[model samples]
Each structure stands twice: as C-alpha cells, then as structure tokens.
Target: MLEEEYQPRRVAPAHLRRTEPPEAPFEFAIRTARQSDLPAIREIYNHYVANSTVTFDEDAMTLREWKQKFAYLDKLGMPFLVAESPSGQLLGYALVTPWKPKRAYRYTVENSIYLGPAASGKGLGKALLAELITASKEAGLKEMIAVVADQGAEASLALHEKFGFTEIGRMGKVGYKFDRWLGTVLLQRSLKH
Candidate 1:
C-alpha cells in the first residue's frame, strides 16, 4: 500500500538565508527552503537515486520539475527546509509532504531528509531531523511517517529511532533498483498530544 505512493518531501523554491554560526559548532541554521537550495537538494537526492536504493526513482529530476514541486508546496503551505553553512552553502534539507491525497490523511505527513556528501556523519542528520519534527508538530500534524528503503536507509532509520520513531512494519522485496530486489521499512511516531 505505502510503496505505491512513496513520494519524498516533494517541494520547490525557498528564500536563501545566511546566519551566524550557533554556539555549538555542529549546528547549522535550518530554514525554510530557498530557490537557490533546490539545485543542491537535487544533487544530493540524485546521488541516492543513481547510486543507492534510497529511492525507487531510477532517473534524476530536472530543475523545472523541482520548481513545479515548490509551487505545489506553496499552494499547500507545506514546510520545506534547508540547512545553510555559516558561509552560505547548502548543507542539507528536510521537508514534509502529505502522506496521501485524501482529506482523512491531513493530520499525517511523510518526511525526507538528504545531506550533502560532505555533510554526512557530522550529526547534521540529527539536527535537521529534530527541527523537522518540531516544525511538523507545530504545523498540527498528528503523525509522522518515515518510509525508508533498504540499502541507504540505515542512518535515516537510526536517526528516526533516536527521535522516538518506532518501526511499525516492513515490506519485503517490494522494490527493485540497481538490478536487485529491494525492501522498504515503515516507521511511525505520534504527535497526537
């Protein structure tokens, strides 16, 4: 069921922003998406699409398509976020999109985060994910879902787990990419309070 519409946090343009480094050196400012960040986001997303099973998409997305997504998010008022280096480089991004189109799913969202190669293993994932969850909860979402694919989802899984998301189900060999069968894991965390 979930494998059918495994859309990532699909979005487009954001305003570019710069900020002073936080007291913690590892912390980067997580801000709403900027138009400038989309290319960097696409570069990071395309890396996984082409080289790993992070996504089932075999082809990279074009810039125009990315812009269209941003437009759609604008219409929905969905949140799209990006991390910026003090010097203004795009370090990573996380965003939430509707888990499904039906009105019944309005209080639920699916999240996706991608970090640049240079940004990996530096606790950036933790920071970005924490901020994303906070924003999602504040936006009135009652549930958060993470749909993680087999090969490159380990860090994502651990990050979500660290933040209190629990594994709810696993679908075996539900995808195929890079010439082999692939799997997907679903994790859930509730914000129903």
Candidate 2:
C-alpha cells in the first residue's frame, strides 16, 4: 500500500497554495474490515502507537499479532471496520474489543477508534462509531465501553458522548508517553440493555 503524501488544499495567505484539484476532493466509505485490510489498519494504528498517548501500547503491532486479533474478534462475531477513501486509502478504523476476559463480560465490549492524522477533524470518526454501535447491538452486546488513554482525547471523548456514552470511571496516571503522564477516561453506553 502506498502512503499518500499530505497536501494542503484550502487557500492560505499565499504561502500554502499547492492544494490543487489534481486529486479528487476526499470521500470515504464505512465497511467491515477484512483479512486483506490488516496492513492498512495496522498503519493507522501504529502511527499513534509510535507518536501519541491515544493508545498505551508502546510498541507497534506486527501483522502476525494483528492476524491473531482478527481471528479472535471474528470468533466472537464482533465488528471491525475501516474507512476507505475515494482513492482507496484507509483513512481510519473503529472496532469493538472485549472489555475483559471474564465470562460474564461477554455482553460488554470496549470501543476503540483511531484516524490517520490526515483524517483528523473530519466527521469520519463519528460515522465510524455510529456504525460500530449499530453493529454491536446487532451482535447482541448489552453494553459498549470506551477506555481512553488520554485526558485530552476530546475528539474521541466527545464523539462517544454525542452517541449517548456516559462517563463511568477514571484511572489517573495510568500511562506515560512522550515524557508525560496520562490518565484513562472510562465511558459507557448501553446497546441492548
């Protein structure tokens, strides 16, 4: 997969003028992730793994690990999605992860959504989350949880809130990334209950 170079589009004080119409204005589609999409999905995820506190994993995920995860989620009949751009670029992804390992927690799942920096500030995140919520209900999940690793995750936090998720807990100083401590924000919404 080719990583598209970022280009500034809108007119800016004459200094940022190269965003021409050579490439089509961006558009994306929401769809279920497939085995073939693991590489693209890993690209978006590991960027944050290497650069941000959005995820607590300090190391990038290998394709083998990703394949295992795919197998696991598939066995649970959960939804894993990807947002593909008009040019066939994967702009973002959202999925339902098991909230915990306990047998009784099968009805509850955690939601994780991430976007490529180029896709930031767009409504793609919202659309993806909405799709996951619907998919979760259809899969018979009773509750959906979100465990955010950053207190500054306003975009993610707000997106979940806008979809009826409510804060249920918090864990302070649970992560340290890029030389600073970060907190975890817990939020939830009932899907079938």
Candidate 3:
C-alpha cells in the first residue's frame, strides 16, 4: 500500500459537464476523499445525526474523532470515497471498515454509506455503494456487512439488497437515540473467490 496522496483526475468531457450540472439531481462523481473534505463531510454527518435515524449516534462527532477515523482507514489500506459535484461540493461519502478487531476477521469488513440531504434520490448512493463494493473486492476482502439502524431504513435496505446483500441478523433495541430505542439490522454480502 502506498502512502502517496491520491488525486482525482477529471474523466468526463466538457459537453458532459454542461449536460450534467453538479447541483442537478443527476450529477455526481465518486472520488477518494481528501483532507480538505473534512468540513463538508462533518456538516453532512451532523445533519443526519441531528435530524435522521439513519445513524444512531445521538451527537455529532468532533474533529478529533473524524481525524482518528481517517487515520484508522488509512492504516487499514481501505478507500474512503466522497461523492461530489463538478464544482467540488461534497454530497456524500462511503467506505468499508473492519467488521471485528480479531485477526481471524481480517477478511470481513463493514460497509457504510452517508449522503447529504440534497444528494438523496439521485442514484448517488447506489453509485457510491457499487464503487465501494468493487474496491473492497479488489482489496481482497471476502465479505461486506451493513449494520443499519432498524427504524425501518427501507431505502438503505433496498439499496443493499440490490447489490446482493442479505439480512443476516437483527438486534432489537440495541441503540438508543432521539429518546427512543432503535433496532439494528445486519446485512451481509459475500465476495469470496
């Protein structure tokens, strides 16, 4: 694994750029996250924590926590990708992390996807998920899991299903947030060769 800084190169043509404006519902690009993206990522995540059940976290993570997460991902040699518009506004991010700390669990990872409010319903989630899945496979992972907050997050469940994830387990009332207990659904997708 290289520690070199990764830069995203423009792959779309000029006409395509005009045809697909970043703010438009259909425009998005998936690229590796950079240090400069921390602010936008924090804002998007905070919005969900403050208003949605997608994440069971009751409070927004501080900058230190976010930095620690980034460092851990780097140590794992996993990719953390951000969805952005052509103008470089981050709309979402997706990544995979170790499912368990044991060395025996090295081949298994957990998948995570998060989006800005404006990025919903535009296929950005699907795009990011597909890319993350492919990247995980290439990086030699054998299985991917999605641990979803089970307040009936239908869209997330459906998206994972579309990518061949199956419900493996469910924990009732394992997370407490928003003054209520939330269930957790564990979905798994196998990529073993």
Report the CA-based lDDT of candidate 1 relative to the real structure: 0.85
lDDT of 3 by residue, 42-133 (tens): 88889988998888888898777888898899889887999989888899999889999999999999988999988888899999999998
* Model 3 regions more than 4 Å off: 1-25
Write candidate 1's Cα lDDT for 1-193 as tens digits. Answer: 5854755434333444455667666657889997777888888888877878888899998888888888887677778899999888888899888999999998888999888888899989898888888888778889999999866678888888999999999998999887899899999999776
**155 Cα displacement, candidate 2 (Å):** 1.0
- In order, the Cα lDDT scores of the candidates are 0.85, 0.88, 0.87
The model with the greatest lDDT is 2
Clashing pairs in 1: 12-70, 14-33, 14-34, 14-35, 15-34
Relative to the unseen true structure, what is the C-alpha lDDT of residue 145 in candidate 1, on a scale of 0 to 100? Answer: 94
Q: Can you rank all candidates by lDDT, best first?
A: 2, 3, 1
Worst 10 residues of 1 by lDDT: 8-17
For candidate 1, the per-residue lDDT at 167 reads 94
TM-score result, candidate 2: 0.85
Q: Model 1: runs farther than 4 Å from truth?
A: 1-27
